[model samples]
Target chain A: MVESLSLPKDLVLGSAILTVTGNSDLYIENYKGILLYEDCCILLQTKTCQVQIEGCNLSIDYYNNEDMRISGCIRQIVWK
Target chain B: MNRIIIWLKGYVKVRLSGFSPERFMNLCGNRSIHVWGVENHGRFYILYMSRKSFLQLRPVIRKTKTKVAIIEKYGLPFFMHRYRKRKLFFAGILVFLMILLVMSLYIWDIRISGNYSKTSDMILKLLSDNNYKYGMRKSKVDCEAIEKLIRAEYNDVTWASARIDGTCLIVELKENEILRQEETVEKPSDLIAEREGEVVAIVTRAGSPKVRKGDMVSANQILVSGAVPVLDDFKTLVGMQYVKADADIYLKTRLPYEYSLPFLHTEKEYTGKKRYDGSISLFSKNLKFHIFDNPFPEFDRVEDTKQIRLSEYFTLPVTVTLRTTSEYRTVKKKYTKEEAAALCKENLKKFLDDLEEKGVQIIENDVKIGIVGENCLAKGMVDVILLMEKRQDTEMVTVTVPEDNRETEE
Candidate 1:
């Protein structure tokens, strides 16, 4: 039911596959998996939540409640 | 409202909430709101708001819409007040200057023209005596009175007038032209017989004689001579002689007399008196009153005459005197023959005495007397002649006969 959800045109979600399991190993596309694993965080990658950051730099931290930081010259933020 | 009114006065627009204070704050979540306040009274206030806010809160503020006037700085009332304040001082000064100018234009000096013998000082003295003088207003000087005074004092003046020229009083005088004297001498003069009487006396100062005394000479006969011979002494020369002669002759004459007496007597006296006032006009329109009438019943008659003499400036004339002659009737006595005779003799003697006093030498006389009707009238005629000696000294001129020249001519 969540996969069939629709949002308005001002919001958008990215297409990336990810599985959520106990102690799963996931390799992020823009960042090295070791950097995420060293942070003692779970790598739960999903195509729905995966976002391709353009003209921006991305960071993920497991200890800060799945907080992802975006930096660089960002033009806009969209949620769909 | 006061703020809005002030803003309007300064060319500004104001906006404010349009509702009760409490309701407006409650509607706005108890927040403070900025409003344009206008003091309508000591206790009440008016608010002005933008169009949008007014429309949104129309139902609330519509009941509070109190129309007010806003005056601009350059409006009629502002300019009118300023102009009134500025003109007050200038208007007062203008009025004061006008009054001063008029006062300065009054008569300052009296000027006289057309006067040769009568001086300006004389005219001024006359004018001053009659209430006209320097620094007097033009309206104050009585022109007719002055003219009358000038005419009365100056007889040679034919006319006089006065006027105001600028700040000076101009007086005009007209002097009368003097009349020429007439000559009464004639040429080739002769002493004619003034009366048809005998040559009682004759005296010739010049010319030759044509008659002698004691000879029968008629009227107009040349008794004394006017023609004379122009001659030199001790020579046949021409000379002039003035002759005189006198003669005594008799004459017969008649006389008559008549006298009338009033049968009744009548008398009259004046019972009424009249008064007169005089005035003169100068320059055709100026009028002046000079005399006031005083009444008297004792006067027999009243006469007044006015003479108008016209000239360039003044009109002058003599006041012709009008007089009244009173007459009355009374009784007179008649004269008898003896009285009339005596009167006639006395008159004749007086006449002869008068002639003797006038250098007439009466040499002889023949007289007669007569009576007529109830009166004794004297008819006396006399040939009383006299002599006037022509004793003029003659100057003799001698001419020497040259003996050698006569012998040479022979």
Candidate 2:
């Protein structure tokens, strides 16, 4: 039914998959870019919105063309 | 797991001291070059990324006008680069790998299972006699031949199988339980005395008693007769009926025991001086460095050896042996008469225990210890009661009765 609307899935149906486990591991799939990187906070760009991750000792464990993993003590996540 | 691949591909710790070092990272990411482990270092920033991505960062470094310098290089590629000029290092690694590859093709261990009364060593010896020992090449070992050889060599083994499992040779055997059935058929036999003894008791189950109680019997004497003589009405013997003899005969016997214990003992005492010898064994060949005599006079040698093993079941035929010979001096020690007597008593107890295990009931033991010269002699006679039986099989004879004799009996 959503395909009948002729809207791109990544833009209209949330193509980005974000998994946060136990406030320690954050896995993001289909991410666009890293807007900001810091020890206490990280801002990532996804398909539909910008993701702001606030944490302590935040570090990007790995990053590739479309996927990224951030690991730290994550306290909150804000999507803009 | 992916990180290990990245590490093997090599990585570099680069310090960017110029303005906006983050731009350098962004530019690297834009060019499809993966970068991770970003850290701030004073006015500079340190980024650890793969070597491939670092090589591709030259254009981005010029664009950002950042000063880039490699602080450290890590991973396998860089490690190899350091040893590139040393030819011996690579040669050693190649030789080691070659040896490992060659050793893995041979059997390093042999394991046997499914044995009840047969020992593992005995089975292993049987295998070794047929070119199936450890360190034999797996390609040369014939599992079927080994199985057939084991079955033919041991009558107890009914079924056998030999196979190679990884670097170990596994052998399994099933023993024949029905091999003892041929001796169970009853035949005409007589129970005879196996040893000289006085008759203690007689319990005849299927035979006539040949000797009564307290009768002195010699070896090979018939204790029970299997023949039953048939008689006529006039007390005339007509024929004989023979059957298998079955009886338990208990006898009283005497066994002599003699043991001697020395009073003066010469023992070796360590003098705290030692000599060492070392050797290398490769493929059953020993390369020894002659530093001292192999066997030192008045000295004991302790040997320690280590073999090269790749896994639990895979071992190479290379061993290093270290032998340490410690010097000693002869010391004369004197044992008290009581101590010698106690030692003799301990030995006699063990002998008595052995006799009891063989179903001999001890009736009386008279042992005496005496000091003869520098030695203590224990002389005695043990009286034991035991059951002795020896069977001789005979064919049953058929006898025909005449019609006149049958009519006379009627």
Candidate 3:
């Protein structure tokens, strides 16, 4: 039904959209809340699963009600 | 861009010490209170939030029971609140900006360049007469009109351009390579002999040659005649055609020269004594002070003054003058025979150099420098070759027509 209407899944089905630029920056939209935030790693929860970003020197540049930006040397992005 | 907005609205760097600062941040975020630059300290967390967000932090603080301490407050709203008592300082700033704004609306400097035959001061005077001068309104200045005015006033100016850059009005012009000789009509005159001399050579440009080469012409004799006789088809003189005579007539002549100098002369011998006086002048008023008195009757005084200025075009009415006085004694001195002869030769050489500068050729020097009774005398007769260009108006000729000739023509 969403594809028939030609709408993005993140906007229609309430799914999270993760945009990573190289190994340094990550942008998350349609996320539920921040499960954990540390200098080394950041864990965010979405509608269906929790997205875990593993990196070194990880820090949140800024966060608001709609999206969040994480920047550092990212090593892994595990979904659970 | 977001940082500027945050700064304008004011922000606080908060240090949360109690447990669950992350939960507090999450609650604040869910409620639409934006926070950024979140850093995790070992036992505490530090973050930045706007003033409005900090107000909503109270409810979040109570729910999470986290103690948030404002480490620093920054930006324009807080700065204004802290300096609310200094009204005069702010008013002075506003007045300064207003003055600067008013100053920028007028032209302050006028510069002219590329003018050679015409001086900058003369051009500036012309511009002032035409209302295009320093301190004129920028909006009233028309660059094209200025160019046209300069070209119109100076017939010799071949090209002109005017432009306004910032507050400076720049006008540049180029003068014609050749003088406006074509615009002026030459007077009808004859080239007469300047002096009684033998003609060495003659070159005619616009007139009939009256004296040939090697001809001995008398003083005031015509070298080139301005009235050229017109000839008909049968080679009969019909009338006289008048024209300005132009020609080069080189003549060989002799000139007399004499110079003398006194044997005894008074010379100055400077003594080893000096005095200096310093003074400062302000706004056309000067108060001079010196501690030393004049010790000698005959002394030379030299003054040097320097004016102070703030910028290239802005001058301050302040100057400093320094005066130096040196004592000198006059003594009678007699020139030796050799020195007197050398001095006469040096002066004679200088005179010849001056003549050479004026395109005159010196063929010989028979001058004699000898010490006479009580003085040195230099006398001679020098031979020279020079050009003559003495002109006088040409007398017109009238032809009387007979009554029978006039009736046949009618």
Per-model chain A TM: 0.25, 0.83, 0.92
DockQ (CA atoms), all models: 0.00, 0.28, 0.50
Q: How many clashing residue pairs, candidate 3?
A: 0
Q: By TM-score, is 1 or 2 better?
A: 2
Question: Candidate 1: where is the Cα deviation over 4 Å?
Answer: A1-80, B1-186, B190-204, B212-216, B229-327, B330-333, B363-366, B386-410
TM-score, each model?
0.26, 0.64, 0.52
Top DockQ prediction, candidate number: 3
All candidates' lDDT scores?
0.44, 0.83, 0.84
Please report, as a value between 0 and 1, the fraction of native contacts recovered by candidate 1: 0.00
lDDT of 2 by residue, B7-91 (tens): 7999998887787665666667668887776665457667788898888887887888999889999999999999899999999
- List model 1 lDDT by residue over A1-80, tens digit each: 33467653223443332222222222233221111111122222333442332222222211111222322333332222
lDDT of 2: 0.83
- Give all candidate RMSDs, comma-separated: 44.0, 6.9, 10.7
- Give the lDDT ranking, best first: 3, 2, 1
Error of 2 at B386 (Å): 7.2
True contacts kept of each: 0.00, 0.26, 0.72
Which regions of candidate 2 fall more than 4 Å away from where they truly are? A1-32, A46-52, A65-67, A71-80, B1-4, B16-32, B59-67, B95-260, B281-286, B302-322, B336-410
Local accuracy of candidate 1 as per-residue lDDT tens digits, B386-406: 333322233333445456545
* Model 3 Cα lDDT, one tens digit per residue, B67-88: 9999999998899889889999
